[model samples]
Target: MSFTNKIKKKGPVDIVKPADEVFDNVYPTRISNISYESVIESQKAVKEFEDKDRDILIKNLKSAYEEVFIKIIEGCMLSDYIDTIYNNLPEKIKEDFDESKCISQLLNSVNIYLVSSKMGGDKTSDEREIPSDTVESIVLSKKELHDNIANKKFEEANKRGKLNNAVRLGCYIRDTKRYFASEGFIQAKASSIHSFEDVSEHCSIFLWVDNIYDISKKNDNPSFEALFTFVLLHELMHLMMDVFDETKFGINGAGNLKDLGQLYGYFREESLANALALYLCDATRNDALVYSILDYFVEGQTTPYQTGLLYIEKDLLKKAVTNWMKCKKGKYLTKQLAKEWLLEVTTESPRQSELTRIEDAIATLVP
Candidate 1:
């Protein structure tokens, strides 16, 4: 019998549904109407749990966690492949899993679990149970999500390239938009391109196709889809930073503010953006690509001159997050004890200079 038939024979406990069903379940929401406010509130709530009564804090955390799951369910639905994967979960785990958290986290957790299982990595964790309020705020109705996908322009864009690449790009844009949106900002546009100059302010993303291919060529590996995915996430991080800075820090406060007469100010907002982006990227599914990128950095491998920007890009991301997390606990440079915290968190590596450059670049870009 065919794979589908065999999966069907395995019964309801087997999550071997058709790809379309899986896709639908994964991408259930539209790109519009995703607000940063909701995401901030969720994160803030997570932080606030520290001050709440223990029982209430756990309840609240569970609720916040569920919001992540709802996002995943929506994502799965959007990819049109919900049925194939749902049966793979244990009945108890599935029963306890919340369906209302940000679909991004849910999809991410599922992807991580699956990938880990396939690689013989640990996959014993249960789906995070979140509160209904958190879940409700993030979840979109099935009909609403389907309608949004139905209107995507990429359906046309996909028809223009090699079928597989086109489809991959299409899904990349869709998922990336969802990823950004889940963090609380709408993506005005997204596209795959040949260079950074092709990046547009109006569009939220510009995936560099040629650059990706060049990297794969250098690595002598033809399959660079995973690498490309990492790049896409990096770019998306820039977009997220832009949005968060504008909304949280005010227009003047967004980006680097060194020229604005602020001393040692580049580390605050920019660092936070980098940190959040990295955290989200790391937390998301398909992180092996991210791991590979980090591995290259750890090994001190540099890309060709033309491709050096990619390393800079990734390094800045690492620096941004590290700096941001430090800032959060009042350990920024302005804080006399910041260096101590930094030493505790990071290893003695040449990457520190790269992080400084990234902070400098952010100041230039935002100013």
Candidate 2:
């Protein structure tokens, strides 16, 4: 069965929403009108609930997994799979690919933590319910702070009040920090964004257990296992470029893909990373059907996640990642040259046979 058909048969019917609905729900509108004092109290109440729920979720995860989630981590290592993928690299660059070194970097370079999410962008039906009142208060407080600066009214900054603006600002900072450690914590499935900075010593990846646990309950447990494995590999790919690729050419680094995308609008690093992870999963499992279901799950995500499937469909993933590794310096100029090379080698005129080949390519991956 095809990936889509399999998902339709076994996956949740609501898992894949129509594109318009996806966009609308992904960027939901939130408004708040609660007072600052009320916001503080609501935040406290929310935090208490969140802390209790997080503890319970963590306990359940550990208890369910026999007190260790190491299997999932071990499964993602894929040493032989990495070797196979790099074996196809050109002879000159093949020498630079060290499986042991890469694995070491993966293990030593960053700390991984499984934690609960703050539920900012949560859409799962089984998600732990944060009180609506508390949520509204948090949103309104943030909005009020934003409007004060945006409108240049500085209503909160007025010196006429008995309580000084400095005091109010400090309160705002404290409350927000208590409610959310960082905005990223609220939305990311797994994050390596901090691992990009050269000076950052405390690089970490947080796998949001709240979302994962809820999603796992909705589907069979193995599906959750595969989903977790894919997410970790994706983040690890980013970490490899950030910490292991000594050339300092981490795709998302300052002058690499991140800057390239911002300056010239060439943004395929996320897609590349996603494609690389998908390949690793397929290689590690050698089960085309399992990987296909994973692919369908990714399709339900936002555009960046879905774009990588194009590379797989076009049979360009192997070539694309190999070219990426070949160009040691991930600068715009360097990538421009690589892009030209890719186009030159893969370019072809419209032909019916080529169309048939492309369709077959996609089918083979999913079959």
Candidate 3:
């Protein structure tokens, strides 16, 4: 009955190899040639298909839709159900529920959710260990004051959780500066090595928070809700590509789970990750946050590689947007059924947002 099981598509193994060296979110990692050129060439071939191959595109489209749809839902903070996210629209944002605007709002809101760390890292909820920084918000009302101050602690203690001091402190300071969502660290490995499944058959995320925190602190301009949200969605996209690559890659092929098929180009994974995040943002019509995240990558970066990846990401996102905008079913995939699935999951059983994250923790602690 779970949408995850229904939608998770392993597809086929890709024969394409990655380049020997590829940038993984600015850091270069070694990979074989099962990579960018291979992926693009295969795609170009399929895209150039004659009318007879149009059916192939349709099947690919359905597969891609389901894959990304699962990713979006998984990224969402479904508490019992995805109850009313974006309820507290920023006062600065105009009151309009048009599709584009709503998408922006959702993107913005989720970053706020992420930065606030309100989602409670990896489901089981041990976010409270981090120190709260909502000390003196003159603006927060009594309830707002309590919620903001009370945010660091998870409402439950059933999970084995570890706190990343630096990341949590960064969020704490930022939270003190802004009365937004709380922040918490998930059970991802701290590395620059971005891989879906490591040699140990474990899924890991490498967030060099020190580096990211450095980038974060550099910007004097206060608006980065989009950038933050984009980063979170980007990580989620890795999961999508790792588990349901054919949905995005559209290459009718096969590969081993550990094969770094998606890890190609200078910033191949990152560029595509950003593309997927942007697509989900558009599909949901979370326009404001969409622009917020895009604008940062577009105009706000200083690091040479960051700037370079943004340039590359723009093109990647453009290709995805074009396909998605033209494909009505893709556009409606998540939006039309989000609320329904939310209700179903909430009523049937509270969906586990990070089963691997949870299982890993249990194994690590219990073993």
Candidate 4:
């Protein structure tokens, strides 16, 4: 009377007949079942074999099923169906298998694959927030800013320059936050520290804007972009020093030059940090400051000598400041010794070049 009673009475009806009955339940009569019938007929063509080949066939079928299951899960298909299918897998195939672990690994792989397929990955959406206290802060469209620069609107150009600096700072802050978050560190508030003393205390950033007159009077030889690149690199060098020290030693590591002079005793580490910072800035912004710093080290000539002097009188002095900022050995280096080390590394020093190359290689491995 019914299909089930008919199949039972027939003593295991033909696989093809049962398959066709199942298909009829799946498809409406209005749509032709020709394709479904072909699939069933093809399945029927798989014949019983000897014991050895039968084992091989079973293994292949299990592998195929696993592949299909993984693909379905990756597509975000029906979760309940996935569970049911997984549960129905043969005991030997499911032995020692962890469904949760398998699903997590597959999901991670899918996320990484999708992210890598995009242009810049997640970096594109990480927009920075500009602080309200920044002078003359105004958001401008990228196209309009480019047009202003092209038309030589000097006033607008300067304003755009300030905004660009703010954006750059914001990006750095965002990156720092990500770095801390990845390391399981709680994020502190984002605010400016007005003094070096204050900066050494809290996890903070200080933005130093050179006097406008000082910047404006310079002959248009060095582009504003170039100036911004240099100053930012210099400050970032200090920031990296702080970050490394904080991560390695912790917050209590900060003190006056005399208090924690031991850390700078290793001149090689300080030089490496400075060089690495420049390399990172160049890789990210294509900044000329990278070359300028390299040239200062290699040729002993500063591109913008005035800015260099204003920031630090000499390479020796700059090295001293770096040592003061980062040295942990608790031993003080005399001003003369700092200058000697700085000159030794910057002039025809193969060691400095090797350090720079190492930094370049490390940058490629990060992000």
**Which tens-of-lDDT digit does each residue in 104-222 have in candidate 2?**
32333343333334433343232212211111111123234234334433333221122211100000111112211112122212222222122112233434544554565576443
My TM-score estimates for the predictions, one after another, are: 0.29, 0.41, 0.27, 0.26
Sort by lDDT, best first.
Answer: 2, 4, 1, 3
Candidate 3: tens digits of C-alpha lDDT, residues 1-367: 2212322342111222321122111111111211233232233222343565434433433333333334355344222111112232233332334323333222221111112222223221111122332222122222332232234221221011222232321221111121111111121122211122111122222222223333444762212334444554565444333321111221112332111111111123334455565666655566665665566553542111131233233433443322222221111122212222212222323233332232233223221
Evaluate residue 86 in candidate 1 and report its C-alpha lDDT on the 0 to 100 scale: 35
Stretch of 10 with least lDDT, candidate 1: 110-119
RMSD of each: 21.8, 19.0, 24.8, 25.2
TM-score, cand. 2: 0.41
On lDDT, who's better, 3 or 4? Answer: 4
Q: Give the range where candidate 3 is weakest over 10 consecutive residues by summed lDDT.
A: 257-266
Which residue ranges in model 4 land beyond 4 Å of their true spot?
Answer: 1-201, 244-274, 285-343, 346-367
Candidate 1's residue-wise lDDT over 1-367, tens digit each?
A: 2222322332221222222233312111112211222321232122322343323433432332343334323334223212212332235434544433222222332111111001122211222111111111212222332232234322222122222211111112222232222222223232322111112212223222333444555764423444443443333433323321211121123343222211122223323433433344355564564466555421332111112222245545454443432222222232222222222122223354654654554434332
Q: Any runs in candidate 1 off by more than 4 Å, and if so which?
A: 1-203, 221-223, 247-288, 297-367
Predicted candidate 4 versus true structure: per-residue lDDT over 100-124, tens digit per residue: 4433222221100001111221221
User: Is 1 or 4 the stronger prediction by TM-score?
Assistant: 1
As for TM-score, the candidate ahead, 2 or 3, is 2
Best by lDDT: 2
